[model samples]
Target: MPAPVSTASALPARALLACSRAYCAAAPRSSDICSSLEEQWAKIVLVIKYLGSKRTLVPLLTKLVEASGASTGLDLFTGTTRVAQAMKTLGMHVTSLDSASYSKVFGDTWIALDGETANHSELVDAISHLNSLTPAAGYFTQSFCIDSRYFQPFNGERVDVVREKIASDYSGTWLEAPLLASLILAADRVDSTTGVQMAYLKNWSHRSKHKLELNDPVLLAGQGLAVQGDAL
Candidate 1:
């Protein structure tokens, strides 16, 4: 005869029901389903465009960590921080390190965030205002895109505007990192590169012609650390 199942393991259904009730009780009240859906979507992972970004491997890697019974993870060479962000989403305490300043911006914004520090409405308003601003040629346009074809002039100008605004107005604030990350991701989306930004297409890709837009950076509520420097 098979051995009887232990009560501790067999009570998972009861435990899950209890957990669901607790979550429902703690959840904030929202007037509309659309607002609630938007709030939930904002907490989802931000899709990053990067050469050699390991976003597709996150699920498998996360499973391995869980199987190992590891509670903490350290990500070295955390470019774009997709893996670190994924691990954090799976409830691990993650420490992410990258040498690139741009990667550090991603790490600080997504991995290090512990709950919502900035007001959502205010952030949305700020993004809307930035997106509506008229585009103009600037350093980015001259250096990377319009002058060199790394990106189209329209998108390049938008990148310059958003970057300048974030640097001048939002720097050193809680809003800075996420806002900057959003801008970088936005630019990446419209870039006319096959993968890396080392070169651009002979002509503009359909994506490059689209107006640049910013989306909210995925913010995790779990504790994390972002380090910028050589991992060695």
Candidate 2:
């Protein structure tokens, strides 16, 4: 295998500038804010919980990145791209690459910067509008069931709605990508299933209940790589 590409510090200034632009475009504010650019703030929190993600690992990853001294970093699998995103936040030029289409979509939307300003209110409104869709037609409905004791129908429905919005309208930008990634995490958190099985589990379904919030896409985030044209 070849060596990986690193985008840690080179892109930070540019990414930060893009984030500010997105903020301004979204809200039309004169003052600049240096917070996250994700539209679905709740989603980011939700993903952290669902993945039982290792924030502790951040230091380790950071150390590795720092040691490498690369201008850009590539996360081939890019699950949550948690470490990568963190590195980006800390002023790295990070590029998350994934084999899975969904994972790629999420990463592209969340981490890739448009290098432009954004409209916050309009983005929020857009999310709301996209969020109001039927459950079965959405992307997260692969293993959901209401009466099987696994997923509460209503709660599952809400998750489906949020997912639908993301799949439908997660454009490439600072705000949309992270927000959608967060929503992917949120849905995984509330899923009434065992971590081992990505599907719902009837027995433990009610043991805990979760409301649809923001999250990263579990399937995409956890996927392993398979080289194309390689035989099993």
Candidate 3:
């Protein structure tokens, strides 16, 4: 009867080395892992702010995908679609799923949009105009920031104006996703939260005090699926 090998330290030196080598061999090579990480990081750099975003896990997830040699992927709880966007950037067909309307907009804009129909320069100009529009105290200002302080009242007013403009002018158009995503990202940039909307900081963050500005979303070129439904 052999003594029970209850711990890894009980293994013979040669057995330990062999196990280590086998583990390394089964894992993705260092270079492949690095490249995958870089690729995934690059994709999510453009994603809009969302609660529980998995942007930080992109590198680890990418390495796992490379090790598995998966050709396609699905992000079942694709909040803001950061992971799905990364998979699409890796040339894997991706399907993004989220129950929230805002997340669906992110997916449609960043992953599923057909950009050829709209002129890029025109969209940029439109965003620039929205950024320059004067802020006014409105619903968002009164509702979220003036009393609640979720954002500086000035920025919140600007958010309201831009949102109303988009709703009136770009509603149901191909430009809607890109334009709306731009606003959402801009608003997130100026929000006074510590990364979520459940509470606001007692004082405004410096970033929140700056004038709000919108940047064009980096739309990917490809056909993908954006589904909004319960994951369960």
Candidate 4:
């Protein structure tokens, strides 16, 4: 299979410049702000490789939002929170609402890290510490690996060990959201899934053979809220 193409090249220069021209007044001039946003969007590490992720469409959506003169965004069905995250990156105060518990975790992670320099520094460091954890056997491994071939035993064991550490140590802290999000992202990377969790591939995917590794979220400084509730 071919290496995956990034979502960055989705927008044409003409359209991107048009978006810059129509952007909000509070931020920098068109070219400068557009360049910054484009740079940031390219580097962002979305926490999930979800089935319905709006990752590719975010630029268009944000451009529309900017044209409307809205400085805030409400994503009612924020499945992977990618759109909400994009809006936040575009300097909007965003609220990502979804019924899924995991959606809330993705939202919460962004909110927790979009803080002062000191707090942001501390949070990232603590979350990064999860990488040092030793892999071990546990329920996640048994359920997702042994019982079902969703992930390799190596990656599954790492997820279990890290998850247990997150529960026992990082629970109730700001670290919880990003830490769990990182673990889930790591496991998903090495998973033998056909995108959704409904079933795993009969054979290990090339990606599945890789060891899991947590990636620290790229911090975007702005106001954000993640609510676990219906649109209503």
Candidate number with greatest lDDT? 3
For each candidate, the alpha-carbon lDDT, in order, equals 0.72, 0.49, 0.74, 0.72
lDDT of 2 by residue, 1-232 (tens): 0112122322454365566667768786554342344323322212222333445677888888888887666665665556656556555666676566556545555456432334556556655564555555233343455335345666666667765555556654445654665565555555555432344543443223655544322222221222212122
Number of clashing pairs, model 3? 0
Poorest 10 consecutive residues of model 2 by lDDT? 223-232
Residue pairs in collision within model 4? none
lDDT for each residue of candidate 1 in 1-232, tens digit (9 for 90 to 100) = 0122333432554455455445555664633644544334322211122346565577898888879888889999998787888788878889999999998888888788775454777777888888888888799999888568778888888888888888898888878888888888787677665433345667565567678999866578777999999989
What is the TM-score of candidate 2?
0.53
lDDT score, candidate 3: 0.74
Poorest stretch of ten by lDDT in candidate 3:
1-10
Candidate 2 clash total?
A: 35
Query: Per-candidate TM vs. native?
Result: 0.74, 0.53, 0.73, 0.74
lDDT of 4 by residue, 1-232 (tens): 1122333433454355455445634455566767766544422322123455566677899889888888888888987777888788778889889899888888887753574442666666776677778889999899999999989998888888888888998899877888888777777677776533436768676677778988877667876788998798
- Model 3 RMSD to the real structure? 15.4
- Residue-wise lDDT of candidate 3 within 64-161, one digit each (tens)? 88788888889998987888888887777788999999989998887787555557998898898888888878889998997798888888889989
Order of models, best TM-score first: 4, 1, 3, 2
Which residue ranges in model 2 land beyond 4 Å of their true spot?
Answer: 1-54, 114-116, 130-143, 146-150, 161-182, 204-208, 214-232
